[model samples]
Target chain A: MAGHKIDGTAIAKSIRERIHAQIKEAQKLNPRYKPCLKIVQIGERPDSSTYVRMKLKAAEEAGILCELVHLPSSITESELLLQIQNLNNDHSVHGILVQLPVPNHISEHTVTSAVAEEKDVDGFGTMNIGELAKRSGKPLFVPCTPKGVMVLLKESGVDLRGKNAVVLGRSDIVGSPVSYLLKNADATVTVCHSHTQNLSDFVRRADVVVAAIGKPGFVKGEWLKEGAVVIDVGTNYIPDTSKKSGQRLVGDVDFDSAIEVASQITPVPGGVGPMTVAMLLQNVVDATTAYFDKQKARHVVPLPLKQLSPVPSDIAISRCQHPKLITQAAGETGIAAHELVPFGRVSN
Target chain B: MAGHKIDGTAIAKSIRERIHAQIKEAQKLNPRYKPCLKIVQIGERPDSSTYVRMKLKAAEEAGILCELVHLPSSITESELLLQIQNLNNDHSVHGILVQLPVPNHISEHTVTSAVAEEKDVDGFGTMNIGELAKRSGKPLFVPCTPKGVMVLLKESGVDLRGKNAVVLGRSDIVGSPVSYLLKNADATVTVCHSHTQNLSDFVRRADVVVAAIGKPGFVKGEWLKEGAVVIDVGTNYIPDTSKKSGQRLVGDVDFDSAIEVASQITPVPGGVGPMTVAMLLQNVVDATTAYFDKQKARHVVPLPLKQLSPVPSDIAISRCQHPKLITQAAGETGIAAHELVPFGRVSN
Candidate 1:
């Protein structure tokens, strides 16, 4: 509120534009490049249907292919798994995302894990989490919400290095992963949860406060530092008699007073909400590019407990200096040291 | 010097005593339950060898089994992989650590990943990192350096919640992970590294500073706020005419000046140093416990990307009380429906 409002909707549109351009360029280079996503829906929930419909609309608008898989609520867990396996092995699919809150009858982990790491564009793959922890990526997709938040920050001229950041919440999707993403960017971050003894103490010390707590109007301006950056990740809604829908979408922050104190803030419905879809589109474009390149995206791979898997047995490589070199370290002979790159990678 | 000196040696000794007591109790319960760690050393890097010896001595003193597998510098990476695999499959090896700087010819990831997550008591395994990131490890084994720092802060009576923490470094081993750990503990953390612009401005704002840059005396006291807690993590040695060895160990912080303004400080040799070994020993103990518990340690399983592994599927049970005797109206069954009561599992 203190700073100018960051227009996340417009920004998301711009991001989608960039991704669209990237996909267009890829298509020029490879005729086979088609950004295709397979979305698996598990039940007849109305909310889930609307969300999928919006995604399909966005995909079409972006000139990407969207395939939907519908399953009954009574479907056996094993049967759903078989479907995921078939998709995982399918070469045509670049991204696979099974809708969340899967009927509450199926184990979420089993369903989430069924999507191969490379195809998990939702950034929920175990290996991707591993890589993100290492500041590395294979599935290469950062989650939609966090990625959108990062884009918003960078585009809005918020420098993360050495900034004291307080994230309110620890949900896997928004809070926890965002903390990791921020740290990877060199920001000092603290995550406050229900068990945190006092929340205001952490908030006042923060240069950036990320409110991901699900409670409506849970954070107030008094808890914020003057000129702080505020990102509201909450989408909690409260019932309103004045509205036809009988509800209003609100964020976790007390926007009225907070806007007066904070240097920059994100609005709720028009803010992070729009960016998630944009970020999802970005992932699709990335998968499309990786597909055409005949390459697999990188993701974190968790090894089994106490079981070491031997790496690919061998690879060939060479390193040396030409005869013109004149140092003990660099032999004068054109024939120099032949060495296999360690970690099977060449360091420049 | 301003800050009250934090006695790392004393704290480390106390921690070691606790671990020894734990080992004694465990042995009483299960006579054959001896903690064991296999450390693989490649080449004669003095630093690596010293660390290995220190760890080995500490493990032995704790009444734990310890083995050192020293490999020649010329050994091919494949051969090292085979060695790690052999150890991974060995039940006797509760924890496995391949010493760092494992030759330029070898990949550190290869070696670290090769040690099954269960045996990665050093907390460098991909799964270990993922588990730490997820904040799901019960009795989680944090990477040693960071864990040591956390222990030091805890022992010194510093409350991390709401504290403004500035960590100076982004190394895989200490800076980055420590930032994550501190953030998890509820401190508003800021991480600074080479890419960070306006470095001093960031440091001056912190309530606490963790100086981990390898540079000797890079951070001055004036860079810190008055009453700020300082945790020096540097182990750098610089020329010193007064020392018999012609060099002295200096921390990243200008200790003389920082001590004056800081409320608490950790010394060079005594600070953060002993704690690393203590944490490693603790991890070994944890591995032993986990092995006997017969549960898949998530810390040992690295999710390849952001996605988790497929969970064991859940079956559809009608929500009506008529369908589930486990619940009335099947409302909130409250019981973890998927909870497995394995052969050896205990339930309340």
Candidate 2:
């Protein structure tokens, strides 16, 4: 590591450790504090199965309980939804993930929408996605892979505010959601995809470049700005005669060229790949804990204030002020308002 | 004017004319057929009220009825939401629009979310936005200005597919959502914003550039590619002694130099400006038509089949299609029956 190589694996390990500590503490308060994850897999694809298997193993290593719910290829649409309804009602199954690319007879939208928003660990459900979209206006659980990417950036100590960031790919699963998260973090974000012209032009100007394209080695180092932070989200596998399994996994960035110019770079396997599943485990643990919180969080959200009728225009809630008050005081003292607010509280 | 100058005002007039024809046809079918729009204003912003009046006049000119629901500046949050709820439930009202930048007191999110998805002609609701985020998904109403940008591009006969496109803003109300629309329409899309480093480097390579930076003459023509299609979304007013109002509207691009180099460009005031309100009126009509198709459309959407338990391990959804029919076809073919099926599309 010439300058800085953001070790996603190490960062993920620290997060898992923190979560494990929280679990241990929670158990003391209540022995029933178990982090449980349930993955709903439809007709199987080898790649998906391998990914699901990796998640299960990772969850177990994190000391979280895992359950795999397998579905038949010939399963009917209503039956699949019924299973989701049951999972939604199950207090023990904290987080639920329905693997993608369902049968032609099924609708992915219907399947995704079926997962209760609280249990949507994959974060593809309509309500969950909608909540994420509106998160800047009000905070909500962000999607996992993007959440993991945010962790890697923050762990590396890069300032996100006002940073120009470009993301490759626009799939709802990664690109668009990541851009939204980056924007929410106060970073100026740009999303470029296949329809995008001259991809290198955008990449060369990025302070942070997130390459989520499924294509291997698509983001060349020359395409990057010198000393830029790089997060490689693609997990493309290519056949390799040298490997025992006749295959090897690589990322979207060209690692050799990237390491020379990057201020911080993540390696393919040890970087984003491990972090994705780790975040899922994190989501599962959070969902299980929240199940006990029940309607308390909802109740705590406060009623949406009295109707707009007969209300004075100047008296509307406007900026909720708890955070603004500190900023206002700092402003009078000539200190940056951000300096007054608690820093490093938003650990991913 | 060089070849790049597009008559946006003329195009908008044509689109508006087409909508008038549609409204007249609907009137023939039902005497009660009316494309009625409601404008809910919470504050007394001069510019916002001017915009509201423009929309109302446009609706009337296009053969649609309109009403203004004036709320005092001191309106309460719940009251505003209740008004939106009433508009949502009223079959007489085809579309609902709430003038933005409401008094600091009211929550934009709360107000936007309160509008029923069907009545949200502005297309700012969370559910509609979520729908906009998915593959093969279409929002009930695409936001006006961005949709207007598309109308201009299509009218100019620009082939969006495989073309390089860059947007110079990331506002959710414009840049971000519009980028998705451009990409979905098949142009490769890259969004460059304030966080971007060397913004010109990206602009220089664009086949198409949409300037929405809200800064007058912010994008220099030299940064533009030769023969580029320019769509300026910026509505900046610069103080000018030559103007009676002490100000004149200008777009983000330096139009003087841009017209000389570009194949097509939209002028500031008459270009995209007129198209915005036109799209709004169009959305009102669409909102009415959609209400008639809601139940029918939702019923056509099938549930997810993958969520069911005991999933098959062998066949993948994409790799194997119409399993039964393919299996039968293969069995008839007599060459290792039941395994091969063409993918992409399959009937239920």
Which candidate gets the maximum TM-score versus the true structure? 2
DockQ of each: 0.15, 0.20
lDDT by residue (A119-206, candidate 1, tens digit) is 7888876556667777543337788899989988998899898787888887767888898788777776666787665678779878
lDDT of 2 by residue, B91-139 (tens): 6788999989789998888888788777888888877777776655657
Error in Å for residue B285 of model 2: 1.2
Backbone-clash count (model 1): 41
TM-score of chain A of 1: 0.83
Q: Which segments of model 2 are wrong by more than 4 Å?
A: A1-5, A30-33, A61-63, A91-93, A130-139, A160-164, A186-190, A195-207, A218-226, A289-294, A297-348, B1-3, B240-246, B295-348
Which 10 successive residues of model 2 chain B have the least lDDT summed?
B337-346
lDDT of 1 by residue, B218-281 (tens): 9988888889888999999899999998988888988898889989999898888988998888
Docking class of 1: incorrect
